[model samples]
Target: MKFEHVILGLLSWRPFSGYELAKHLEVEGRFLKNKVHLSQIYRLLSRMVDSGWVSYQVSVNDGRPDSKIYRLTASGEQVLRDWVTGPYEPSTRFQDPEFMVRFTFGGPLDHDALLRLIRTELECRRAQVARFRTRDRTITDLDPIEGVDTAMVDRVRELSHLHGAASIDAWIDWLQRMLTELGGTVPSTG
Candidate 1:
């Protein structure tokens, strides 16, 4: 997901100064972005302003620097809506922030769009589970250097594979449940 989309999503909540934006990102919006520097937020805001997607108004404080409180322009709203309603390409990393980001922003904006996003994620994760659930995880050592614990390596590899498979399966199950709640058809897991 583009960083701008994240910013747009935040703005959709309410107009915020750059500092507030940073604070929001650090707290409530952390899932969307773990760590974003203050300067980067300002820079992106400036770019959005230039693109005619964002506009800001300066607010004077009694004993502080003037703050530019940012808001989305009509163009920005359209862009955000288009992006939310557009196709979602699932990330290979099952727990990537992409799903959370899209859902947080898009789900509230449009119902059908939310269903589409969830459906896309569900299908992708289902495919991933089918592809990797029972794959052979054998590790072949070819002339390994001394001191390498081949057995330990194999155990770790198998554990990691199992962990990933289980995580994706759980995600798919949640998606199915969510689709049901949203009145979307839950596809067969076969």
Candidate 2:
């Protein structure tokens, strides 16, 4: 899914400033591939406003600069609903960067080439889980602080890493099984 959809999904929950939206992405139970900065959010918000998918209000807070709070419009809600209910079209352009990289190098890469890519991805995910576990362990060793929600954040990160790792493992297994069923070989590169 596009970042646009994710932004819309957040707005669907409630109106928020661009900064607030970035925070929600950081803290919420969503898989964050990277830390989203406020500038990126504001750029997307601007495009969304121009597209009439979202509306915003500029208001001043006491002791603060003017902020634009954004909300999804009816049209935006319809667009989101349509996206959710629409037929799935696998978008090569939208594929993850690693996947795209493999595809770009796949001219002479045959079935075994694809399987190797999957295996490599699985290994990367395993390393990711290890890193996340280490981070979680480090967090656990910290002394508790009042009003700090470190534990909750750690739990979210742990689960996200675990789930993501499990998913990659599952895909790896499925691909290996399929390769085996296909006589342990993919079509030869011509």
Candidate 3:
């Protein structure tokens, strides 16, 4: 998802200054998988305002610099609603922030669709694990040729596979736990 959409989602909750937005990104929004630069928040906000997705009001403070408070526009709310119900593609289960952003707005979303998203994500992660295992196997089974550092290559590949495997495992664990918490049983992987 675009950074602008993330900003809109936050603003949907309430109005905030760029500083507050930055703080939200640093703390509550960390699950987003990517961090927005504090310096870039204002720049992005400017673009968002130009796009008509958001608008701001300048607020005067006593003995302090005035600040611009941002809020979602009607168009922005519609855009956010579209994003919430739009088809979700977990393109990269581990790195994508779309799921977290969707979770942030979960209160107003369909519970069944959310459950389907979790199941789809689980399938994607399982496929990732399979790919990792295949790569590891291929790395292990490679025949050494002359002047080639097959051992070093194998070691690097093994580490990469392990890292990928661990990430998928962690995601799977989290998905299962979420399912349990939602009073839904995890589907059998067998």
TM-scores, one per candidate: 0.94, 0.48, 0.79
Q: Write the per-residue lDDT of candidate 3 for residues 32-91, one digit (tens) a residue.
A: 746778789999989888989899999999999999999999988888878777777887
lDDT of residue 169 for candidate 2: 59
Worst-scoring 10-residue span by lDDT in model 3: 132-141
Ranking by TM-score: 1, 3, 2
Candidate 3: regions farther than 4 A off: 107-109, 130-136, 139-149, 183-185
Error of 1 at 180 (Å): 2.5
In order, what lDDT does every prediction score? 0.87, 0.62, 0.79
- Rank by lDDT, descending? 1, 3, 2
- lDDT digits (tens) for residues 1-190 of candidate 2: 4677777766777899988888877886235325788799899999999999999999888997888999999998777655544333332222253343332223123455545554444444445445554453345466667876886878886787677657755754664565466445533322
Q: Candidate 1 at residue 121, lDDT?
A: 86
For model 1, where is the 10-residue window of minimal lDDT? 135-144
Which one wins by lDDT: 1 or 2?
Answer: 1
Per-residue accuracy of model 1 over 72-162 as CA lDDT, tens digit each: 9999999999999888888888767878888889988998999888888888888877787778767565566899787877788888877
Top model number, TM-score: 1
